[model samples]
Target: MAALDEIQTIVILMQENRSFDHMLGHLSLEGLLPDVDGLRQEDMELTTYANEYRNRFYWPFLIQDEASVIRDPPHSRHLVQVQMARSSSGKKFRMSGFVDSYIQYTQHQTEHPPPMGYFDSRGAWMTSFLARQYCVCDRWFTPLPSDTQPNRCMAFTGTTLIDDTDSRLIPHREHVFDWLNARGVRWRVYHDGPPFFLLFGRFHELVGMKYRPFSELAHDIQHEDPGQAPQVIFLEPRYFDFFWSDEPANCNHPLALVCHGERLLHRVYTALTCNPEKWARTLFIHTYDEHGGFFDHVPPLPIENPPPPGADFTEGFKTTGPRVPGLLVSPWVQPGKAFHGNLDHTSMLQLLAEKFGSGPEDYSASVNHRRAQRIRSLSEALADAPALRPIPTRAPEPCPPMPSMKRQPRAPNERAFQKAALELLQHEGPIATAAKYPDLVGAPLTP
Candidate 1:
């Protein structure tokens, strides 16, 4: 194993709802890199049948310039089964039912479903640049076969006791923050708006002190005493809600334009790499929480350990969800390298446990045991890699003009994560005020 001392800071930026193939599968086609497990000519030409006309719909070639997707695909538990074409026996995943699932979800209203679409490297230049310059993991999957909240919970704590994305506060569970705190490992959550950590109320005090506005991140990087800087930093992109606000969401939710996200990646990369000394000692990771109902050809593997014996074992999380983009950025990584190891959200926890000793074993014994047996630590990627000087990166293109917001109903498929986020603000406190700025008092809650 490589010495943890080589890397001083670890930064994670998790965006929303994009599959690996959806975003970066065209890297090879674009001549960016040759060995990446990306889309092939046959893959691009595959078709799925829709019942409407018994029509054979050819998979659309990569869409390079579109900002927001035309339609949000359904990703709820029931829909995922349809998307994967999971057999009734639960032993086979045919990976052939996406188009049919989309049609059913939209009630056959949309003749063309966006889930069948993909993006070439041109659509996600920043991601491609990072993957080309560092390492791209093609086999990374989300921990659970569910939506945002549970998968995110798995990233934070080694379990998601809850199975679905219902609009409610997350139940208290052992979190990585508690582990880091016990071991004296410094960490911080930086956000452009409401930090997602607020969703887990158990760590409210920790979130309050460690959570800082994204604006302060650059300043902290430049001015803070090296010894005082946080060892682990999580950057939360601004999330889009129905409420009127000046900041356009950059989290890349299906409804928001992706250009904003590209600019965000630029901001984060520039700030972290500006200082050579800091850049050399830092390792930044970029990934998505889940595939967000996108089409992925590879079937997720089954895990030996499911969530403990009791909590929602009915739809056991034995198998990981669809593949999502995972990039490891650092001066140490070899350019154009692609790691094919099996990794999921808990792999991060495994890495943290290795770097800083695992904390409070009794906090969630079953979950911890399951994590130990299943998740693969990502530290292996850093092994035997020689550190190099920071490479210069081009400035991200300017964002497209903002689209007009219209009074509309809240997306029917909107994740409960967003609703819980807004609910976090209903409480009367300093945290509440900071989270719920530009009051949404007049805005219709459903819209």
Candidate 2:
């Protein structure tokens, strides 16, 4: 049998707005996984020089938990350029200026900006536990430096013709769901609420059949026939964008507590691992969509061949963004192993293409060019370890109780992608859009 045949299920859970250094950098401090590429003694602290009005230096301190962050830092394309501080020659990325950029866009001034902070394993227990028990990709970067939607577009369609995360509906492109459907691969998207796939109008049809509520995941795992179960699954945590109402917003966006997301992870992991037969053949992956303007020590790798331009984006795409947390949980991966190969959101597409073959050759030109980049495949991590490791018996740490909702004014730097998405819904008619996104019912479009 082919190597791909050995795996019967692939589950991907993509979270939001965290950098590798911000989330898992301190993993090494625990000393459980010594070989992992995590924070060292010298890396515990980082300093950024700023001269907004006078010469000043800012040093990053370790944040105790995620809830302490009051404001969502600006992560627009222009602001990210300031954060990276690429050299004039365009050959070197300095990875400085975070404090300066945060201060420049923030409406409220504070003595300490949240952008200049990192979290240790204590606060990110689920992420740390998953990384320690399976594989962590230290070199995995987001395909773009912008905000949520663009990098998410890269993950779903293997290209982000548009650069920002405005509220506009994505242009018609070959989505991963379409690819899986074409190849006769069974797939499903289990989301806590309104599915992100709804953002793309083209995927509306599949939403009814393949999309499901989060509750159904556990039931399906326990009762669905193993042969008929979805071969590919995309799990979505409760997105923080819908937090205006009383709901568990567990996607781990800056405004929400990380503990909520950790609880979701624990539930997902328990559901998948409960059955040994299914667990042995399943490849579970957890990753972040983008760095969300957090501090990452490693600079993005340059992309030689940018994706073909779209109507919205004439400049084309170039350069991967900062490293984000990537964990591959599988029995096939040896415990404590770290994969350092360069990877990004498109790497998921590359792996799918390798396993199921690329969909219709003419489906998408931009996707074809991205494939030509020869990105590393997720399957590569399993090549060295042919035998399965023992299933984990320990339970994840208990998550703290959800805190009270403290409504705050929306950030002034809301990205264009979010605005565009909301506009698309409005165009469809506000009443109907309100039925789907209740938070935006009476909400003003103006920031």
Candidate 3:
């Protein structure tokens, strides 16, 4: 409780589409984070962790050169189900369908598979460094075994109406921003390009003040009156859709150079540490939206929660999605800690309620229900023990130049982002939007 009060600011940076085993599994395999529930030597050498496709068995292999040549893996609801391929007993997943699912969806029977590839410490330098230096929530999972839209909706709105990505504004009973505003919580969003929240209604009005570009984050952290600074801030990376005409995909979505997201992590950390007093009181969290169809040996936990009243998926979510990487950064956090608590995205809202509202249940009854079912708050990541006083700050090697494509691709999520950018431009007028978010200038207006 004291840790929550001493910390005056909480910043969240949620990247896209990478999974726990694919990104950080190698951490344990390489002896860096030996305690983490990551890849093991046996998993790589034996058939126990192998996935069978056709007559061939595949094990996790090192993805070298930052894996720029790797293609996006299929992560839709049905495909994810295929990837799980639960054992006959229905109590566990064989996790053997990943290679098959990839070949089936992409029709790349002869091509090198991407889902079984994993990155080592040097490959995922930024994430590994933070994990080694602070606390890593090893058991955190995405709320559903699906793709971006539904999991993200679960993160921000406590519930989702759809189970897959669609090219439209996400319908939510209430947005987190509305909840924050009603309770008078000061919050802000900083984006490298177009803010992801534009997918929700009222994005235009929010863009100018509540939603600002990445450029202003450092300034606000260093120069703004300490009391006037936002209590919470969300940092949105350059999504994959923006890189066709803009910068590299910094959110680490499939097909993106993972280094871009690493570089983004460096930038946000640097900005926060640039202000020592603020840094002392700030808590920065880093996590991914979903697994992006990567291979994970762990099966989803069975925690049944009925879907929203009008959800497209009539049946509620039966289990949590595959694990995603989660990091907790704060001066109050014990260094070299690995928290194994069972947590999900809704835990963030519960943390907020503990800090600002009545108690654990103040976030919402839905979130409180999940709490009753054993979902924990971020507060657990904060330590009451002595902490690292002088926060280490060393910049990492620059990422390689992003690979180029001949033309824009036709991913549905990309089109949805394009639509959101267009709606923002239409609502605020190009001139005003340009002044507010210069990065959205060339955002595609059509699918």
Candidate 4:
């Protein structure tokens, strides 16, 4: 393993749904990265990756106005099963069912489903710029073939108790935070609103110093003591459930303006680079939790293991979910290359083990199973020494305004988060929970 000790801190900013093909596929379509496994012209011309619905086949088309709000695609467990179109071979897939799956959710609005759309470099300016200037992992798949919660569960815990975004306190073994804590690895969360961890428990530290607002990240990056700095920092964007808040959701969830996520990326990157010496010692990872029902050409590698007994999901997944865009930014990585080694969300855990634990298997037994399956870690993306002497920082992306919502929780994930907060209220008492997560608990939730 590379001496990752030189990389003093690892920062992860996991944005919401949106796939590799939908977000950074333009890198391939525009011929900017000839070798990238993104969208292709022939796939469109020959209709190789087209999906048929309502007696019409929908091919990937460029979204001319990505700044405008679009509809969310279907991404539930059963819906993703339909979307994958698992072939008789079981290992391979037709990979052409996104449109059919989307219309399954929104039956009446069948004209031009969002899953069949692609964004140009200008549309996903921040992501495209980063991929071009850093390392883009084109083969990074969501660990689970389901909705946001389970996939995120796999990302953080290396396993899942639920397959769908069903509302409840997510029961588990050891979460990533617990694992880090047990090993004495300092970690922190910086969030724009209520941190997503509120969905898990009502621990005192979770509501205290362990979580801070994104507004404080710049100051911390510039001024925090190097030895006392957190080894792992998680950045949480404003989620869709906070639509009633003063700020618009910038997580790139469907129906959200894409530029908002770009602005958040710009904000975080600029802050990290403000101190070049600190930036050189930091590795920033920007990826999404799942595909959010967007179409991607790459089928997930075959899923082989079944969840342990008593998992909320008993039916074993046949494959990982679709490929999501993953970017690696640091002075240790060379720019302008696509790292094609197969990776899943657990790969990050493998990296943590290699860095701080005994070995790759030190993450968890579940994560070791993936390591046995050749799931590569983020460690491979780093060099033994810093490759880029003077790291390049891209120009700030000009973010436009997105239409705000002051309505009830309409999205499934939004309602799920609301439900988790409700559980927290029952466990921690109304006054305490509400004080901890004012906006999240103050807003009325539906049963």
Model 3 ranges with Cα > 4 A deviation = 67-69, 110-112, 403-406
Better of 1 and 4 by TM-score: 4
Cα-based TM-score, every candidate: 0.88, 0.86, 0.96, 0.94
Which lDDT value does model 2 have at 202? 46
lDDT of 1 by residue, 78-120 (tens): 7776777776898977666777777788776453567766776
Candidate 3 overall lDDT versus native: 0.83
Model 1 lDDT, full chain set:
0.71
Question: What value does the lDDT take at residue 400 in candidate 3?
Answer: 72
Window of ten residues with lowest summed lDDT in model 1: 45-54
Per-model CA lDDT versus the true structure: 0.71, 0.72, 0.83, 0.82
- Positional deviation of residue 29's Cα in model 1 after best superposition, in angstroms: 2.7
lDDT of the structure predicted as candidate 4: 0.82
- Clash counts per candidate, in order, are 0, 12, 0, 0
Off by over 4 Å in 2: 1-3, 45-54, 107-111, 304-309, 358-368, 371-374, 384-389, 398-400, 403-447
Worst 10 residues of 2 by lDDT: 45-54
